[model samples]
Target: MSTLGQRFSRWMQSRTLTGLTPGPHDITIRKDLRVPMDDGVDLLADLITPIGETDPRLPTIVIRGPYGRRGPVAGEARALAREGFPVLFQSCRGTWGSGGVFTPQVDEQRDGLATHRWVREQPWFTGSVATFGPSYMGYTQWAVAADPELAPDALCLLVTMPDFGAITWDNGAFALRNALGWTQMMDRMIRRDMLPLGLAMIRPDPKLGRAFGVLPLSDGDTAATGRAVHWYQDWVGHERLTDEYWTQQSHTASVPSVTAPVNMITGWYDIFLPWQLRNHAQLAAAGRAPRLTIGAWGHTSRGMGGVAVGEAVAFLKEQFAGVPSGRTALVRAYRTGEEEWHDLPAWPPPGVAAEAWNLHADGRLSTEPTAGGVTAYVYDPADPTPAVGGPSLLPNSGPVDNAAHESRADVTVFRGEVLTEPVTVAGEPVARIQFRSSQPSADVFVRICDVHPDGRSMTVCDGIRRVVSDDGFDEVTVSLWPTFHRFDAGHRISVQVSSGAHPRYARNPGSGSPAFDAVTLHRAEQEISHDEFRPSFLDLPVWAG
Candidate 1:
């Protein structure tokens, strides 16, 4: 290592993660090592190794992703190398200096297995191999997870899901902002355009916002990136999970087949939390001991990144080096509102009980169902309800005060009495609504917020569903994101009902036309009924112990 790189590593150890013990060895990086694939395409990789280590049996941690190898993952690679584990950080095909056309999630299985086979033949390899990284890197790990002969010895996945298609068409509604924003980001990165990426980090870019509002969602890629993106076009075109296109790109079927020890970390406001939890639950149901940690963060929260690195280092050390992991339990979750961390034997800990809070016509929430009426709102596609704060790729994501959003005419608010004591919610919250729309199609967005004594209502978790029914009322069950939040004393629990959270989710055409192809805009008159026969309520998983 050069003097500057050595000094930087020391600085990172001191400032970034003070709790971790400094590794004993100096690190060296070998740049641009070309590894040939099955079809003779060469993928670029950088091998990070300890300078003078004699232990050739130490494990190698392989991290693969489309992002440049020297980006954010460099710190993680160097950290592991310093601790005596060799690190191979490879760029996916068609990214950076790698060969082949870039098609997300398609080439990973073949490319990853080929890379691992090459690693085992290297002169420095003699021990078990583990795969580590976050987001798309996690996807790369899952892509080869079911390979009977090439499965990794261990996996460390953070803030990612296996089914990219499910996240693309979440709840049967197109994920406009996330899908388009990510496409634009990758396009900019590949073309080396840094201005927009820099501006997006500090504030929302107006041009990108305009791109999200473009009609015929198929044109969004061109509006955002100045050219049509093939992946983005395919994402918008495929609307069903049962499609063969989606199945070909998905790795969800590999979860039950994974036999390696696993560690997963995610955030409360992450777009992939629901599916990530599903993977965790699947592993647990099969009697696999996978460790999981959930933090109070958005997808891009800096805090989440810091925590993930620490957790990964500890878990990898425990698995490969026989080190004692200091964790108190199998699962660790951060509780919002109260801002406390709880360690438990499992998630949705055993003491949770479902409690129903009835919604009244007068905008009051109570335990007892009473005589109520319907609340109506008009949702105009031209000026759809705007997204305030939730799971988004932008910097403005996470829990934000929704006071202004709640005051909009297109939104309906229900409030419960101030809590005299803290009410802790530990699991998923479901919203059961009796809804009807004037048009053939509409969307129902339900959000749960904690109203502070100072009148600031901050979002906790929310869910959206695309509805298609006749003019009469139809029962809709919108399952919100699972949460661990506390409603503090003197704070009231609030629920916001609206037709759309524009840009975050594509606007429902209300004419039964596909959002990506629709040219006609129809205004939808939406109704939420809370009566004796069709009572609307929120079912919360309240912890009883």
Candidate 2:
């Protein structure tokens, strides 16, 4: 280690985790230890270990990510270490005290393997290894698992995407809100060391209203970051989902090859919920089955890990001791509206079937197709429909009431009669619309809500489809985020149809003009036509068994 590294390690050893005490064991904090890489660079890591355990070599767990290695996870690491297990908390190759340039989603395999190798070399390390963390940390665990030579014995992952494109190009529209919010935070993290306190103290969410409103999205990165975030700009520059840029950065390509058992934890309204849920099916298709639990929460549900850590430890202990965990089911999903957890044998719960509730012309949804007409609205780019609540990373994002946005003229809502009995929807919801747009291009934003007896409609989930084909008409399928919800007696179900969701998805200017750059704003005349001949409806996943 360099003199600076040595001094930093000494300083780290003396430091206590802010607002948290050390664990119950005679714990030792060895910080800033350098793990050597193949190319002669060393990455920084900290170890929390028990001082006087009977075993000289102990089973281990690792958490690696770009964020500060010791800030949020240190307490968790200490606690795990006190349970007679070694915990390794390491910064990714580039970030914090590590010795590499910071890049996202592209460099975890080599560094992850190096850290695992470093751990095995320690006198206190056992042969068995496991990995656990959330978000980017969870991603790092997956990235590392891609390597057969370095796969951990078990995994505990939370709230992460299978591929980067899911967040970059969600359901065919640019994920403007998520990209902007995340990159802005990263910009601050990168600059804090070099900037003076006066200059460094950027607000956590600095003027996102103005930043995301910038046109020609190429400039949006500079507007949000004060300087160009190359990755953000790269995402903006490559707007197509079919672009090779997204495919090259995808981690899903290597996901199926991983053989270790995985424990996945996620939120119902998490920003990555769509992609994370997709991963479960993907894994099953690839002959790998992972344990899962989805909760009723949003993106920043880190505290959920506490209850889950015990489960992780139990799983790891079983794996480390050559015992298989006799888990029967594949999923444990939380029912949101009812606020209850349901242990299931499979996703979509065995016999759940789709029930098409037909969209009608008289501003009502019914089981029978009895009406024929069109509900039309003019979508103005200048006054686009605002995104209220759904699966987003923004403030106040989740299952909030949608009454405020429902009143907008550009938004058309179709209501259903009050249900005499309870209706439980347990999986993905699909909206198949037989529609037309006056302009050459447009967007269809669809949302499902549960209307209380008193008429308060709370959003369940939403989706958007950008249509470029204006061939007189088209049928667009908008897949809403999956949910475990129940509409009780006297409550009604409704669908909110609109042309845009504003910054959550980049608004369609309705002109077929170049992506998000065109200033030519066309007032799109939107129409939803449903009749006996042409029926538009919502295919809700009604639980059958």
Candidate 3:
């Protein structure tokens, strides 16, 4: 280690890790741990090991992430280390402490494998290892496992997309706004020292702290904004769902190659629920022992302040201890009302049944077949349906309830009668629509919401369709992302149809041109047909609670 590294390590050990009983110690915070790729370019990493546990050969947990390794994960690393595992937290090449230019998931596969190899060679590492983390950190774990030679024994991924292209960039036609925010945050990290940049962005302004509220301070540095700008442009440039751009970021294509046992943790309201479900299904189909736990809360639902972190720790304990297959435990903890943890045999529970609710002309949703007519509404890009609630990116500084937006003229609301009994929606909800557009092509947005007796419309799930190359009049199947929610008795289920969920999803110009650059607005007359030739309905998965 360099002199600077040694000095920094000593300072952290003496000051930062002093009082906490189960804290990190003998912290050798080195910045130049070399992870060499096949092409000879080396990635850098920062290695921090716990004190007092001097086992020269111990099982290791490799955290290869895009964010700086020496940042927030330190506490979690210490806790895992206390449980007798050596933790290797490495920044991805060209990221924080790493030595390459940050290009998101494109270089992760190579860098991840290299980091795993480097970790194994460390004198303190035993042959066995695991990979884990949340979001981008979680993605690196999957990328590392994709490498044939570097596959770990176990993997724990939380709230991460199975494929960046499908989930993050353009989910069908809707662009993820949270992804744009994340790219901006990462852009700042890429241009400056990790600690200072993080502090500046998150620190409350001394004078206007309360007035500015929780918005991260922005100095308007373009270099600090490069990641967001590039990501937004790249996503917009690729209009087709099956285009090469999307293909390049898809991990779904490589699922057959991963050999590690997987544990996936996700929230029902998470923006990446579709990707999570797809990943789980693909892994199970590939004969991998994949475990999934879906919670009812949004992104930041785990850890201390949200729900119980003990559940996650217990799951990891069982996996690391070589628990038998059937004996392994599965836990799903929700945040609302009861806030209790529920144990289950498998996800979707096996008892969930598909139920269809047809959209009727008179602003009604019903299970019985109905004669359908087209409901028309004009979608103006200047004032799209504003995003409220549902799964969104953090720091989530927006309103949690979306009931107010239901009254918008551009948004069409269709409600079902009050439920006589409780119905639990436990899987993906799909919207099948047969419609004709006045223009060559247009996009449609669908939102599934739970209406309380007092008239509060809480959005449960949503889907978006970009009709870029539609044949004049056609029936399209829009797969709303999967979700788990219980509709109580007397509560009504509702569907909100609109053209856009502004800022959450980029507004569709309805101009029939390129999805990204066509700013021309055209009036589209949409017809939802429900006859034999044009049957339309929402396919909901109902569970017997």
- The most accurate candidate by lDDT is 1
Question: 79-127 in candidate 1: lDDT tens per residue?
Answer: 7787778899999999989999898888898999999999988987756
Task: List candidate 2 segments past 4 Å from native.
Answer: 1-26, 54-58, 193-204, 322-329, 394-396, 514-519
Pick by TM-score: 2 or 3, better one: 2
The global C-alpha lDDT for each of the candidates, from Candidate 1 onward, is 0.87, 0.76, 0.65
TM-score of each: 0.97, 0.89, 0.84
Candidate 1, position 305, lDDT: 59
lDDT of 2 by residue, 421-453 (tens): 888898889999988988988888899999998
Clashes (N, CA, C under 3 Å) per candidate: 0, 0, 2
Better of 1 and 2 by TM-score: 1
lDDT, model 3, position 485: 73
Candidate 1 regions with alpha-carbon error over 4 angstroms: 12-22, 54-57
TM-score of 2: 0.89
lDDT of 3 by residue, 1-545 (tens): 46685456445533443333333334444556777776777776655555565444445777777766555455555455554566777777677665657777878777777677777787877678877677787777777667677788778777786577776444455544565456655766777645645564566323222211111112112223422355555665675658877677667778767887777777777767788778777776787747777666466543321112233344455666644435344435342322445666666667888898988778889888878567777776645556665566544421255577877777878899999987778778889877666666666778888888988787678888866535444766788867667788999999987777766766555666665446556666666666644666789988775
